[model samples]
Target: MTEQQQEETTADQLFATIGEQADNESYDENKVVNEIESLCMNCEENGTTKLLLTVIPFFKEVILMSFECPHCGLKNSEIQSAGQIQEKACRYKLRVNSKTDMDRQIVKSEYCVSKFPELDLEIPAQRGQLTTVEGLLGNVLEDIAIGQDVRQTEQPEAYQRIQDFIEKGKKMIEGDAFPFTIIVDDISGNSWIEPKPADAQNVWSRVEYLRSPAQNARLNLGNPEAPNVDDIQPDEVHTFPASCPSCARPCDTHMKLVDIPHFKEVIIMSTACDDCGYKSNEVKTGGQIPPKGRKITLKVDDADDLALDILKSESCALTVPELALDLHPGTLGGRFTTIEGLLAQVYDELYGRVYSGNNDSREPEENKKWETFLGNLTLAREGKKDFTLILDDPLAGSYLQNPYAPDDNPNMTSEEYERTEEQNEDWGLNDMVTSGYEEDETPAVIEAPDFPAGAPAA
Candidate 1:
């Protein structure tokens, strides 16, 4: 058939228009077109169904596209901005203080990371779902309910935990529980939160800022071009040789110096073993090695202190001295974030052990101990009880920004002390294992196992 005839055939196959006929909805204000002779992206079925695109006028011009496959019932929906992309990634934090706040509109793009810190709920972005504050809460509850019903059939305690989270969310929505924060990180800058009235006190007091360069790069914001570390001057390239922990294969390591905010230069080191495909990485800041180990402490007096910056290295140890709480490096990975964000992560880990396990089968005494721990954690987070955060790093990588040391507050303290022999050994600072073996010992050779698609190599 001629090209014109084929085009006419495809257009004739699209018998319905999305704006007027398919759903019989009115979208007179914004332009809505349907049946563009599009194939189902999922099923790859040509001319079997029509795709819908609607321009919804809101805080920004948003183009909504949806496709459904009649053969396989596959469905997908996406939101794209009509204007130019944002120069920088943005974060929106909404304080869910009252029922009125729950009515706030939220335009969550697929690339947004939605999080409810207090409830230990985090929904990472992949698929976009536009919803309101109340609607978001409902979505969370529904997702928890459905997932628990399906996955936790054998674990009654897990179901109970999800139910408890749902109940707490409902209470927050109804203004019964303490106010919580909902933070959304949108790399595309397509997501938005309804701003409160200007007359309201501290209406925009919630945390909002442009994400860091590393963060923007991670999100593929603006398709940032990666820096070529090899292009650096020869003097800047630091190279070392190491044996892989996985297969004992000799590997070449490279450390590229890069500048970070608050720090002049930090070394990004990576080691990859080609033999067994083993890889490891570590970040070290460039500075004179102090004679003594470092100890940093911060007192959390109120909610504002939660916003204090914390840089915890993978080798650093964290302790809440007041609560007799201590966390080692292996328990959690390093993170550069605020006090509240770190606490939320620790809480989620602890919460998983308490509520999302076979706790119902455990002794009553054991359960009580966990409950007491949870109570103590809640007290520390609510600022009802004072707590001191202590960060110790044998290496000078970890840092706790002294809120008062920098400005007016006098509660924070940072000191360098001698590292105990035990502390030094624990971090492998003086361990023989860290040093490459001499010629006397031959390196072990292990065959790399085949990993399934998308699986990490072992």
Candidate 2:
């Protein structure tokens, strides 16, 4: 047998062993179990440690571990993510006001820091946990009360302050503290808060930001040594070792620089995992951002228009006025695909978000509205409906194929305009001083331009 076949067979045998040890014939297909004896932290005695590897629906795989020490009657449990670190760090904020909000599920990875802004309490990175908002608060209370008895005798003032804080936490868990915010920031981007139902008004918000160099180093996700630029040929694909985002298994990523016929050069990157059969690809524009933003509007008159190739950069916002579809920037990331394929992706993203096994929770009116919107999107994807497609890119890195080539396509129009101050700030271009820093004694301040009354605000 080949080396790859041998590896697969070994993996199968290992899983079989784990299944036999678990001794459950009706275990879920997405779950595997194993057990071992480990030294207990409390008693220093051997304790049974059970590990369950399971995949969360709509999310990724995670390992759940539970330990029981018979000698000390101690028990503990924790959760660890099995997926690779994401490209950017994530922060989730949720305002808890009702009982249901306290019951919201939370996935706290080892690198996650949770904060209760109103209570002035912060829980730094510790053991990973899969719990609810109320359970998290309970754990915090337990941790804080550990040495309170000793402190009450030795340091009465400090002990009283902690007792008051613990009382507030208990009230918050009991729903007495009605409105407060819980923030979970994960540098590894593996933590998440359960999203609200489609029909419910959600008070949760999430933001993703680039990690600083120090944060990356702390997470052990720092950049590798830089490669020599001269070694990479423009036409040749360069392959490098990387981890699969889905399975966290070792894989290879291929990248190549390609030039479009009528446009500038771009870097194409692709990754495929042999173990999980997961694949992903993206396009990155080469060189610097353009000085002026671009707006492209296309009138899709027939099926032929849906076959045109398009490049939508990460900074582009797509809109379909007729279909009432407006996708903000960074919605689908960068993509080099045909119009039909892009529309299909948009349909899938929206459909999955609204109808991911929560049909019973949706109101009739909301359900019907979403159904109609999805139906129209499906028709547009199949080229059975005519609609207007608009691409607004502040970086001017997006492109739509002109079927007529040298001659302008009558159905399409393109224009360039100066970017607004807000757009520049969003792209981090305002702080970028390319030259004259050494000779300048002071920095220059830029003032915003005043516009007429009816003009749109930036």
Candidate 3:
């Protein structure tokens, strides 16, 4: 059949008239009609339709698969995979009238269309990566030792190098929680962490402890830690002035991202999509690395960052981009402040969040719910005593330092302990299943798995 064979009259709706694109690019024609004719007299009424494929995102990889729709898209994508490890036959969801002997298990979530199995090939590949730590250290090492063998290494030049590495802290990991080192090398081979931040604040260690479920990471995307290294809160759909940066359209596409690091500070990252091959400054930030070179750098959000936002927003019961732009920084030395002062400001921020979420007087269950939120028995006990705060916002440690507030709940009474126990139990169960001792294990996490087919099925 030729590409444009028409069995039925043109649809009532036309893309040319509707104005989505300049032309009709839909899969509309007789090949589909012919296929439908083989199955039933009706074609369009009971035939193929478009569907979104199930997405499996892992560390540095994305697998797209499709689900079958028996002439209509329903009861499809209903067969959820709860992180299953013990693979077995699953029943075909929408099998039509067939003989009892015709096996349906083989039909479940069609892994490949026999006619087009070459499309979704899972070809193997690999990529080399250098971590942020390695990159920064490598640069410093070259700068320091570029001509070291030519002459005797000088003294004050050596001291100056240390100062530069320590103070500049180009992309230091500041965890904002516990004591951690920020070891950085200067123009010389020496490396030392900013020790005062260790005594005064905690940035690196807390960040080191940040472990994520890597369920939706991509392959060869560099270290999984890249996300934390360039940490920004998840993307949030925010409204911008409905004017284009280039064409000045009344309705432009602008989106918002929070906590993108500016020079020694963090700020909101926003952008607009174009309508007419539009013109505007095409980059987000100009070489974040301090230099004479001035080309702007661009960073796009990934699927995992999107997932991170969903988890964080739900866990905190807080809207993503959780820390608003300049919420407390203005009161904390206008943006840049001493470590202690910054900590104070962050504490006040947490206090404000707690105060806003407070509804203790409503009911006992409400009190229990609040207790559940803190995930700390000592904090809950302190809440029972009467929650008080210093001011608008302060850093985490400062809030933890309240004289009247309960100290850290490092004991069994806390929900942290209870949660740990539950997790341990789950881990053991998972181990048992992996060992094949248990026939069917409870897959703890469940999400819709990918569909059976993709445009390019392999």
Candidate 4:
């Protein structure tokens, strides 16, 4: 029998056992069939593993299954609904204000997406794991601890910041903070934060519709004909053309729309040049127009600041003014990366340019300047020195997280301004043709270069 079938059989047998016990003695809650011999999936050994199944009847009937292979020490568990699949997705929002909230149970399915906005943190869905609110905090702490160790070696200042976050999380678990919110988006509708008892007063929790089109698409619940790739039509795809930056050969670029979890719309564009086998990738906003041009600036006072998330549009220009760093549009496109990762990229590129073999003949003074800049940048990343990060986007699609936002974060500020006439011209916004041809008119078409063999037709 299949593993699932075997699980059902086990549950049925356990139910029968529970029923037999009811006749002999008074029934008790938490009916469990533990230590049952089972084949080890990991080692492919027979009867070397133990399976534990518990029946939990709360608001709904739930089955908790756990198994462990003593030979390989592999353990697995899952919480499954005895009822039919939920017709709609579920979202659980918890306003954590006291230690009691931390004691609540959290059942996270493999498809649950957890977001902690206060910490500017998000944990993408994975395998189902049963944990309490406090245990969830512990899991986040464990992950940060591992990250801290790596940062300790590569980014000492960021390591110190992570250590501080861990300490703060510990205190928060003990009910130090007044209020924080944790949101769980479960596309499968199998996850939940335990509800407070009816007798409990002033508890904060709620359920709501996910209402995200992208999320519904991810769950494949929006279309009954989904999971069939053949149903896709030609009109659904978007394509454009551009010259390869390396070879200057005509290349076809394809744009695919994607959504960033708990964020805005994005388009991933990919193109490859058959002539030189050069590939290019870039991200752009999904045709969003900000009301006005924006300039965002942030002060990096410590390594903890590096955890900030940035969404830089393709038209955005970024720089570290303190280091005389300037990155304009066309130099680099849009991206979503942590502040620390962006700095590391800058450091690697500069290091290569200064110390590479081709640059060995550079003047001594220039070499000294490059070395000093590198050292200073390192110090700034470690929080030993302070620096300012500025993002200027004429398109106004860039964003930097403000930790104290809606309450005014003192270290960061954002401003909007009108674009200049010259700026509008440069972006081709002012050069549009207002005239349109008649319906019967067909403009002359220019012939495109022959695509390489086996390429999709244009």
In model 2, state the lDDT of residue 39.
98
Cα lDDT of candidate 1 equals 0.61
Better of 2 and 3 by lDDT: 2
Per-residue lDDT of candidate 3, residues 60-107 (tens digit): 111122233466543222222222211111111111112211111111
RMSD of each: 18.7, 7.7, 27.7, 25.2
- The TM-score obtained by model 3 is 0.18
Candidate topping lDDT:
2
lDDT of each: 0.61, 0.77, 0.24, 0.63
- Which tens-of-lDDT digit does each residue in 1-458 have in candidate 4? 86655765665555432234343345564444455678877788654333333333222335556777767788777666544435345566677877767877787877888877677778898877667878888888887788565788999888888888888888777787648777777666677776432212123333323234455566665663355344322235577677775445588888777766545567777888876677756677765565578999998887889989887776677778777566554334566677876776667755653453233334577567767878877877667888999998888877787777568778898899999876565455554433563453754222211111110000
| Deviation (Å) of 46 in candidate 1 | 6.0
Candidate 4: worst 10 consecutive residues by lDDT? 449-458
Clashes of 4: 0
Q: Score every model by TM-score.
A: 0.40, 0.68, 0.18, 0.40
Tens digits of per-residue lDDT, candidate 1, 1-458, equal: 86655764554333222233334445343323455556766677853333343332224445556666777788666665544445434556666667777877677787788888888888888676656888887877877778676656788888888788788888877788757887776766667776532212123222223454555666555343555344443237678786665444578988776777665355677789887666666555565545577777777877888888777775566778666566654335446678877887777756753453123334587567667767787788777788888887766678776655447457777778888776555433453332455553764332221111110000
Off by over 4 Å in 1: 1-31, 37-58, 71-76, 150-153, 199-201, 205-213, 219-458
Please list the residue runs of candidate 2 whose C-alpha ends up more than 4 Å from where it truly belongs after superposition.
1-33, 86-102, 116-122, 141-183, 196-213, 219-237, 243-252, 259-264, 272-279, 291-304, 317-332, 346-377, 384-394, 401-433, 436-458
